[model samples]
Target: MKILRAEEEEALSEALRVLSEGGLVGFPTETFYGLGADPFNPAAIERLYEVKRRRRDKPVLLLLGDREEVGRLVEEIPPVAELLMEHFWPGPLTIVFRARTDIPPWLTAETGTVALRVSSHPLARDLPRLFRGPVTGTSANLSEEPPARTAEEVAHYFPEIDLILDGGPCPGEKPSTLVSVVSERVELLRPGAVPWEKIEKLLKSFS
Candidate 1:
């Protein structure tokens, strides 16, 4: 794994090039570094699973730089999801929605729903927009291992990756809260940086 400081446009462009070529990249997100790959590239996604030793049954999430990218993946954005996106997107909330049938089959595994987030971290957020598509947002770590907060740590864990965009150290907070809106109701899958209480309160106001 090569560690390239993401201090210049040149580095980001090269990272994008790697992504375009279906190679893996480690990028800094608000909570931790996320491994990036073209969501449409099945071979790349399989390689990611092999590298992380992650089970194929556990689906990975997609990182978006723009909300418009959402239309390209999900079958529909339920009202609850739209409301949550309005309030918590570009932050730390990852909302899972029913995937469109045309979306890459490998992305949703057996869940048939795709987890999506509009990241606030500059690099993580910008990469998708630059590439004009979503990127896999799985934490850059081996399965069951703690997520990496620094580029060096990512390098330590993954030597099989194509590149690591070293955006210094991440904020290293709790990882993003994960929720699902695919069942016609909001369900909390993982409570994290975004407190469940706050999400409950907001939904309560409308209910």
Candidate 2:
């Protein structure tokens, strides 16, 4: 597998090329190294699941360059979701929304909802912007293994992955907080980088 430094322009360009061609690229996020694949590509998504040995039932999370991209995947952006994104996005929070009809079943795992995060990490944010589409932001480790914090750790787990954007060790070393907003209320699915108290306070403010 080719290893590239995330800061280099040439590496970024190559990573985009790989994604456009339906290949996987391992890159660092605020929390951990994520295996990125074009979320719109069924072949790429399937390969990602196969490589990580991820269960098909568990849906993958998507990373976006900005909040606007959320509309492309979900049917509607609820008021509570908008409030949360306004406060905590471009950071470590994944919000689940009712997906648009066009989104693939593989992406939603037939749950009819998609989890998304507008990443603050430079590599994570720029990648989707450059690729001009969403990318899978799942941790680059075998299912149930500790998430990889460094590119080297990712290599040990997914040596055959197409490209590695080595941005050095991730600062957070934890997954994003996951919340489902299908109903009017916000349900905390998983808590990690963002504290639950913070989210609760934000929701209370909206009320």
Candidate 3:
């Protein structure tokens, strides 16, 4: 696997080039390193699952550019969820909402709910912007293996990836906080960078 320096302009250009070809790229995020692919490409998504040995039942999270994009993916956006997105997006919070028909069932696990995040990491932000649509942000390690925090760790874990963008060690090095907003009820699926107390407070704004 080829390793590119973090934030190196040439590396970014090359990474985009590989992604455009429907190949996989590994890069660092505010949390852990993630294996990314064109979310709209079913074949690419299949490769991702095969690489991680992940089950089809587990849906992948889409890293978005902004809140406006979120509206396009989900059929409805709750008011409280909006506040959370506004306050914590582009940081480390992941919000799950009812996805629209536009996204394929494989990406959303055939469930109406889809996880979306606006990453704060520069590489994470640029990677998605370079793609036709949002890219999958699942961890680079094989299923049940500890998530990779560095580019080398990712390369070691998934050697078959087409490209590796070594953007140094992941900062905060934790997974994005995950919350699901369904039927007006907000629930925390996994707490990572954003704590539960803060998320609960945001939910109260809706009440």
Q: Model 1 over residues 1-207: C-alpha lDDT tens digits?
A: 567889875888999999999899999999999999997888899999999999988889999988878888899988898889999989999999999988776889877889999999988988998898889999999999999999889999998899999999998879999999999799999988999999999999988
lDDT per residue as tens, model 2, 1-207: 999988776999999999999999999999988999998889999999999998999999999989998998999998888899999989999999999998999999999999999898988999998788898999889999998999999999998889999999997456899999999589999988999999887777768
Error of 3 at 139 (Å): 1.1
Q: After superposition, how far is residue 140 of candidate 1 from its true place, in Å?
A: 0.5
**Candidate 1: regions farther than 4 A off:** none
Candidate 2 global CA lDDT score: 0.91
Clashes counted in candidate 2 amount to: 0
Residue ranges of candidate 2 with Cα displaced over 4 Å: none
- lDDT values, one for every candidate: 0.91, 0.91, 0.84
Q: Of the candidates numbered 2 and 3, which has the greater TM-score value?
A: 2
**Which is superior by TM-score, 1 or 3?**
1
